[model samples]
Target: MPLLSADQLTIQRGDRALLRDFDLRLAAGELLHLRGANGIGKTSLLETLAGLRRPAAGQCRLADEAAGLHWLGHRNGLNLQLSAIDNLRFWCGINGASPAGIDAALAGVELPARARRRACRSLSAGQKRRSALARLLLQPRPVWLLDEPLDGLDAGGLALFAALTQAHLAQGGAVLMTSHQTLPAPLAARELIL
Candidate 1:
């Protein structure tokens, strides 16, 4: 079964119709990349799929509601006041994951022990982005909706994301994301241009 299916999806902002008459299906073990110019509603499209917004038209269906989803938007979605470890702890608690994996998740994103203890506000932009990405490893959800997921990453961060995403796909999880950059080599994706 498809992880997510959207039929004739329409996206709008205020009175402006950004995109219309779209269709998409994301299958398990697959990745779909959304390509478009800025300000063309890629974020809105992702929000609609993640169930954060109602589509202007059409509907979206997820194969398993209990399986849940992971959403990474343009913002890192970190609490600047909290340390990386603490932020992940809170996410783990909310997502029904064990806090024990926090250290491993941090390490997966290449965050060092010292930086993990520092406040997110004190970390560099790339570190903050990595901290946010670590949440994806906190729990196993069947679907991930990411918008501009690699916006601030350096080469190492990019490589790290590729490895993490590849693993997720290997486990039959699906991803629908928007990125201007090409997906790392060896990670195949079907693209939809808006």
Candidate 2:
């Protein structure tokens, strides 16, 4: 069965139909990329899939429990006052996941041990982005909904994210993300243009 399915989904903003009768299905171990020009409802579609906003018409369904979905928006969702480790701990607690892998997750995102101790407010843009990406490692979910996940990432960060995404798919997880750039080699992804 598909992990997620949107049937004849319609979304509108102030009578302007961003998307009409759109449909999508994502199965386990699959990656779907949302591609389109700006103001074409890519973000809105992702937000609806993430359940952040209700669709104007139709509905999105998840085959599994809601807890299996992880939504990562354009914002990193990190607390600037907290250190990277602390941020991971807080998120893990909220997700009902253990914080024991905090250090390993930080390393996975290419965040050094020293930087992990520094407050998020002091980290650079790329570092902050990596810190946010570390949450994926700390809390493993079956479905990931990411919007502009590569926005602040550098070359190396992009590679790391690709590797993480590939590993997630290999583990039978699914990913739905929006990105302008093409995905890196070895990660087969389907494109959905809005």
Candidate 3:
């Protein structure tokens, strides 16, 4: 069965229909990229899929329970006063996951040992984004909903992100993300233009 399915989904903002009769299905180990110009509701669609907002019409069905999905939005979603490891630990608690992988997950994001102990507000934009991404490694989920995940990432960070995404796919995880750039080689991503 598909991991996620959206049938005849409609999204609107203030009576301005951003999407209508939109349909999508994502199976395990699949990657789907949402593309369009600015203000085209890419974020809206992702938010709807994440259950952050209600769609104007239609419905989204998830094969697994809602908690089995992960949503990474444009914001880093970190507390400025919290250390990188602490931030991930907090998220792990919320997800009912173990905190044992906190160190390894931070390392996966290329955050230095010293940096991991520093507050999130002290990190650079890319570093902050990486910290947020560490949550993915800390808590393995079947489906990922990412909005502009590549933003603020450096070339090295981008490579790391791609590698992580590929690893997730290899583990039978599905991803639905919005990105203007094409993914790196061998990811086998399908594209949909809004």
- Best TM-score among the predictions, by candidate number: 1
Q: Write the per-residue lDDT of candidate 2 for residues 100-174, one digit (tens) a residue.
A: 898888888999778999999999888998999988888768999998898878888888899999999999999
Stretches > 4 Å off in candidate 2: none
TM-score of 2: 0.94
Question: Superposing all C-alpha atoms, what RMSD in Å does each candidate have to the true structure?
Answer: 1.2, 1.4, 1.4
**lDDT of each model, Cα atoms only?**
0.91, 0.89, 0.90
Task: Tell me the tens digit of each residue's lDDT in model 3 across 61-136.
Answer: 8998854788999897899899998888888888888999999888999987889999999998899999999988
Evaluate model 1: give its lDDT. Answer: 0.91
Error of 3 at 81 (Å): 2.2
Kindly indicate the candidate among 1 and 3 with the higher TM-score. 1
Strongest candidate by lDDT: 1
- Using lDDT as the yardstick, the better of models 1 and 3 is 1
Cα distance off (Å), candidate 1, residue 98: 2.2
Q: Give the C-alpha miss distance for residue 136 in model 2, angstroms.
A: 0.9
Instruction: Tell me how far candidate 1 lies from the true structure as C-alpha RMSD in angstroms.
Output: 1.2
Off by over 4 Å in 1: none
lDDT for predicted candidate 3 compared with the true structure: 0.90
